[model samples]
Target: MSLIPKSHPRAKSLLIREKLVLGFEQGLVAREGLLAHGRGEAFDYLLGEKTNKAAKQAIKAAAAQILLAKLPIISINGNIAALCPKEIINLAKISGAKVEVNLFYANEKRKKNIIKILKKNGANEILGINPNFSTTLSGLDSARRIVDKNGIFAADVVIVPLEDGDRTMALRKAGKIVITFDLNPLSRTSQTANITIIDNVIRAVELLSITCKKLSKNNKNTLEKIVKNFNNKKNLSDNIIEIRNNLTRRSRFA
Candidate 1:
């Protein structure tokens, strides 16, 4: 049972921290990931800890992009695995995207642990584990460069939730459409992505899955239109404005 009461003002945030702490204890999260989450949490606070209109727009565009893609892959890491494994699987199922584990702090044990949790959450074919099938993504020297031959390497669209800037740029350079979830609209990952959902991943993943299901019935032309009308730069700019507006509102009550 969660020690955090739902009535607590910061209950959700506290629970997220608890999960990451447990994930670290389980060998599913790196120490670096914990620090990363703290950074994102600060940005989350700036956004009023809620999904904004701009993020919803980006999610819709992202769903359309995923549906239109010939090959879509959702990249997973320790933080994502710890936070929302089931949501990731559902998004893949709804969007026809493959699930692949790619980590910055890659290791066999952690990979197995992430895969194990994913499988437990209903994922059937998790990739990026076997070295024999791993192919190097040019322009990246981190362990994240090693991608499954049949997954991110060959995918046309990739949903990298909580991604790093270098790999996002590398994927874009390799002629792939990159979609990512980031709290900070100014981050390179947010700017480099073809579609950027500026919201908490725990909320964004579920919202994306729901959006994909709703958009699945739309015609190809409609989906293409949604994708075409979206401008990542503008969407990110709107998010920054939302943060500024939110901070201004909070200051009034202070």
Candidate 2:
């Protein structure tokens, strides 16, 4: 029944592209989002579309941060919503965090459509669409500057999957604990995040959701310990080494 056959050589990659195209057609993703998805797919291919050990560790750290925060908010954009709406909603429910729609490409209609998609996927409460509820993340002039007063602005911890660099820096400057999913470990968003999972957003969110659910029964002390022991810089370095090793192995064969 699927348009992309399961037996195709590039089935996984093609499916990912198809999802982004569908997202754009459904008004759940921005036009620029297709381009971003392509960029991420390139890295995903290099990484073999597998969650590396370092990325798994980062996911654990992100889960711990979510469990440890007094008020955690999951920041959603069009790409994220389109790709993993149900996963995001499930993670919020498991972690007891709020869901807020925050798009870098700001548009009222797109925002509303994203919210509708999330709601359909079981997001009971969504924020970040009210003009009256707007607040600025200081030292940024992008569309990401606008945030909800009670969403990203008020939360002590925030999860930003498929994030932009400028907003990642601004969130850290605002003194919020930031977690991000970025394919490029060398990217600004990865470097700026308090915890960066160097994996595709789909795998990152799925792993984060599972980890959060597993840690749900654990106490705050356990969660805090996990967060305290995570090393962001080392994780980034490990991912870089992974990519290099893969390339070296390929070059030797060639």
Candidate 3:
């Protein structure tokens, strides 16, 4: 295995177990997997990996919106695998949502691996498209997306953490309410989502879990208000411009 870069800051939570398990699926690939993982890590770092005021508010609002769903699915990606597995499962459970593995690289092999990893990390009730016992998602099954028949059509709301653009677009076209966490804020995935959290996955999941636990029937209207105010394209454009201008202003020092 290639050595960790010298410039990398050691993450307190990503222990040897996390690294060993995650290193392969992420490190094993070139453009397809690891690249996305690394970029997400950067976004996580930028957001300080903590639930700030804005994030908590978003989380509460998101929870209220999510609770309104008849068939809510919590979609996980590779970056999610590398960051917060239990948190994702826990949040979904608390919110009365279903946990399903979804990735850009759709396959049984990767899907199974994701399941195995999540289960090892205290995850139960992991859902899949193919309920067949033998099919592995990351390794065994080609595309283990058993949640929806076609692109989240059956879903009223889909909580997609660290999503891919293609799937997000397809879900939108299917008219599903798509909520996601995105660091870049300018990517198509962010632009197309119903609610976009401009923060790190670790922090985003933490807040989401907290919000769901504190949520109740009484707070439904509050959540509706927050969600009602959310517009993906507007939020994406605003954050993207802010990030770009920040980068440009800093370029003078370089």
- The per-model lDDT (C-alpha) reads 0.94, 0.88, 0.65
Per-model TM-score, in order, reads: 0.98, 0.96, 0.75
Angstrom error at residue 116, model 2? 1.0
Q: Write the per-residue lDDT of candidate 1 for residues 129-164, one digit (tens) a residue.
A: 878998999999998999999999999999999999
Which digits, one per residue and each the tens of the lDDT, describe model 2 over residues 1-254?
Answer: 14988899998778777887888999988888898888888887777789999999999989988988899999998998888899889889988999988887888899889989999999988988778999888889887888889899999999988988988888899899999989998899999999999898887788888998898789889888998899999999999999988888888989
In model 2, pairs of residues that clash are none
Clash list (residue pairs), candidate 1: none
Candidate ordering by TM-score (highest first):
1, 2, 3
Q: Count clashing pairs, candidate 1.
A: 0
Better of 2 and 3 by lDDT: 2
Q: Write the per-residue lDDT of candidate 3 for residues 1-254, one digit (tens) a residue.
A: 34555456664434422553554545322245556656766655454555444555556667778877778888776557656777887887788887776655666666676777778777777655455532322222224233444224467898888777766776677678888887766678887787888777666787777776777555557767767876556666656565566567767888
| Better-scoring candidate (TM-score), 1 or 3 | 1
Candidate 1 TM-score to native = 0.98
Clashes of each: 0, 0, 19
